[model samples]
Target: MAQKDGSTGSRERVLAAAAAMLAEDATAKLSVRAVAARAGVSTGSLRFHFPNQRALQDAVLARIYGHLFPDEQIHDRSLPARDRLVNCLRQALAPTGTGQQARETWTKAYRTYIASAPTEDVRAAYRAMDQAGRRRIEYWLTVLADEGALPKEDQASRVRFLSAVLDGLSIERALPTDESILRSETETLYTAVDCVLGGA
Candidate 1:
């Protein structure tokens, strides 16, 4: 029983450490060695809990998704479907602050992921994060589709279009802009939402 308890404790610690790293930098590499070092556990121990990087990433993302969307507003039938989806997409863009804070955030991102040729690990980390975002957007679309609120459009194409709009808006947040930009952002989000809902 003691051995089992210790094993569970080690696993939790490793997961907590990995999640912390991700929270600190969304594009952080979750190499076993790095996670083990952060967790104060042996690589063998981390591997015992998570057999591979992909497994570890998936687990971490699941944990994060649970925490982030505990009360998912997308399912609120009281609101118009378009409003709910626009709200969901807005939440996805919430992290990109405006003005100087946004500029600093973008600066850090550029230095970390775009300043030079990224290593394979960096590329993999970025891809994992990007895919997670795509999955989330796709999930939102699927929910609306299931409710008959959205047309039976190609889900992948819709996700791509919405993601591109969000990405552009995020970049705009960091640029020099006027106060009206916030209203413009909302208008843009509405436009994108309208496009996906087939102007319904």
Candidate 2:
């Protein structure tokens, strides 16, 4: 544990230091001593905040998830459910073309998280996120079913399958910086929807 000379809680300071380290080195090299040094705190203070390595790792994982999939309000109700689904998929899978540096940083962070999977806390975080996504997918499937574009009884299966497809494609697209390949991935979402909905 470490204690900071300045107030504002040593745990927060330690988490901030860990996040900065990840930003710089692409993954958390979060030893208590290293984090304390970075935060200008004593090792005992760090322990007070996070009793063990796993506790610190859990915080880091939570921060990473927050950075990657931030909560945002979507206001556009005019678009069809299918179109909205496509739009969400595109935004999630494609780089927004803001700048190469920003995209590269995101790519690096994403890869690091992927490589460190199976942590219990991380798995729980993933499940919560996945459940939210599944709810949205089920909403879209219900809309399609109402329009006779999808079978009523197939809602769960279609949503599950589409969710899996989207998850796999996202992981694949994260592997490379090729814009063409990413574009292909976005297009594949449309194809997947078409196939799942019986190819209208």
Candidate 3:
């Protein structure tokens, strides 16, 4: 069932609907058939785009990040190591495709994960997205270590540690008050980043 509006195809509709579903449920009830129904397409059409759970997960992550930083310039690989980390965190805090650069998205994501405890597949999908974020962070961290900006002994652990902190902060993004409060939270995040990277 092709939608009347101008979407690319079943693929685009599926991803769009899936992302919205992920936003609302606070759990990963992201079954193929369910998503298909949400997209108003057949399961076959949905699978034609996603093929499998991991594929769908990857697409969801890609959709979120891609929309957040469509013209990404920090991934040039030639920029300074510190700049990469800054850019990485910048993207992390950016508003999503729907201009939700605030904390509500984090609340929804947390809710989704809480709801996902009963389903290993949904849990794995969440972990996959988290790992994807970690991998991006790791790339910049590795560059920093290579440039001698970060410690070499525990690079892997360092990335994981920082990623965990950042991810947690991301969840608390919507918990701030006024502008001053937001600034305070932002400073806390920067401090955590500094703590993780061992200060620049």
Candidates, ranked, TM-score: 1, 3, 2
Q: Point out the higher-scoring one by TM-score: 1 or 2.
A: 1
Error in Å for residue 197 of model 1: 0.6
User: Candidate 2: worst 10 consecutive residues by lDDT?
Assistant: 68-77
lDDT against the true structure, each candidate = 0.82, 0.64, 0.66
* lDDT per residue as tens, model 3, 8-126: 58788899888888666535558998888999998877777778865685577567656766665444567755556766676665653112455557657767887557488777767
lDDT of 1 by residue, 100-196 (tens): 8888888987887899589997787777778668767877776688789786457778989998998899899988765677799899999999989
In model 3, how many backbone clashes occur?
5
Q: Give stretches of model 3 more than 4 Å off.
A: 1-84, 96-103, 179-182
lDDT of 1: 0.82
RMSD of each: 7.7, 13.4, 10.9
> What TM-score fits each model?
0.66, 0.46, 0.52
**Model 1 misplaced stretches (Cα beyond 4 Å):** 1-68
* Candidates 2 and 3, the one with greater TM-score: 3
Query: Which numbered prediction scores highest in TM-score against the true structure?
Result: 1
Clashing pairs in 3: 26-111, 26-112, 27-112, 95-101, 103-174
